[model samples]
Target chain A: MEKSSVLTVLSALAHDTRLDVFRLLVRAGPEGMTAGSLAATLDIRSNTLSNNLVILSAAGLVRSAREGRAIRYFARMEQMRDLLGFLMEDCCGGQPELCQPVLDQITCPC
Target chain B: MEKSSVLTVLSALAHDTRLDVFRLLVRAGPEGMTAGSLAATLDIRSNTLSNNLVILSAAGLVRSAREGRAIRYFARMEQMRDLLGFLMEDCCGGQPELCQPVLDQITCPC
Candidate 1:
């Protein structure tokens, strides 16, 4: 990912509501969740949720698809992975041991 | 990391100059880089770099240490890993296949 694009994605995630929404969608997995469901679960107004979704979409972190009458938002796993990778490329100064905690946290199921 | 702290860190990295600074420090590893050097390399004013450094320090993404007459900044690797892990958990719907690109990009020495 380009630096500016990655910055945009990170910026979109630097908000409480938006972060929560992204986390929720990540947990929901590739199947995703409908906008109405996200709004209900997050207890955020539809207008506000819509705005957040727009930002996420613009950042390419999430993609919304029309499924029936609802728009389902799924985490754009590839873009997200790219963003994460970009930030962590040189993590722990090439000593993997120093980054054990991070690796464990991400890899551990529990 | 708490959600808020992660948000703060992400927010700090959302900017062009700050992100470049952080990435530079990360590439510099534990040795870190001096404020003046960072400013010169990035072609940003010292005052502006100082402000960005302050934000990065506040977000716990960077730490400043007094080295001789100058303070050097290093990437807080643990916090960075935490931030990356937090965003990447449940990535690719647990298939792991989908996140291969991200992993390769980060782990590849190229």
Candidate 2:
């Protein structure tokens, strides 16, 4: 990811509620959760959750897919990978070993 | 890596200049670089760089040490590791393999 894209993603995660929501979604994995369910779980109002989700979606951290009457939100692993890569890009001053441990973590199942 | 600490660190990184400076510091590693040198390299005024450094220091992302007349700044690797761990905590829902790649990267040589 470019610097701008990284900034966008980080900004989306800068807030308390949004960060909580995003972390939960990351745990939820690709299957995601319904908007209403997320709201209920977070103890947040639907409107507030919708607004937070919009911000996250805009930042490419989370995506929403309409499933009948409910909209499910899932963390975009690719975008997240891009984010981790951006921050780690050029890490260790050209010595990949310095960053090998972090790479060992944060993998995509697919 | 608590929520509030994460917010503080992320807020410090939210701005363009601060982000650039922090990234540079991270690249510089434990030895770090002098304040004046960093300002010169970034083409940012010393005062502006100083202010940004204060924010970063306050957020615990970087630490400053006096070397003669100038203070050299180093990325707080422990704090960074904490930040990463906080974000990745509970990742993959007990399946650590899911985060192995990222862990493979971002390690300390020590």
Error of 2 at B1 (Å): 2.7
Q: Write down the lDDT that model 2 would get.
A: 0.80
Report residue A69 deviation for candidate 2 (angstroms): 1.3
lDDT leader: 2
Runs in model 2 lying further than 4 Å from the true structure? A100-105, B94-105
lDDT of 1 by residue, A25-102 (tens): 887886889999999999999999999999999999888899999999988767775676577665556654554443
The CA root-mean-square deviation of candidate 2, after full C-alpha superposition on the true structure, stands at 2.4
Instruction: State in Å the error of residue B61, model 2.
Output: 1.1
What is the lDDT of every predicted structure here? 0.79, 0.80
lDDT for residue B59 in candidate 1, whole number 0-100: 91
Candidate 2's docking class is: medium
Clashes of 1: 0
Task: Give the alpha carbon lDDT tens digit for every residue of A1-110 in model 2.
Answer: 67888898889989999998988887887678899999999899999988989999989988888999999988877787767666665554456667755554656662
Compared with the true structure, what per-residue lDDT tens digits does model 2 show for residues B63-82? 99999999998877677666
Worst 10 residues of 1 chain B by lDDT: B101-110
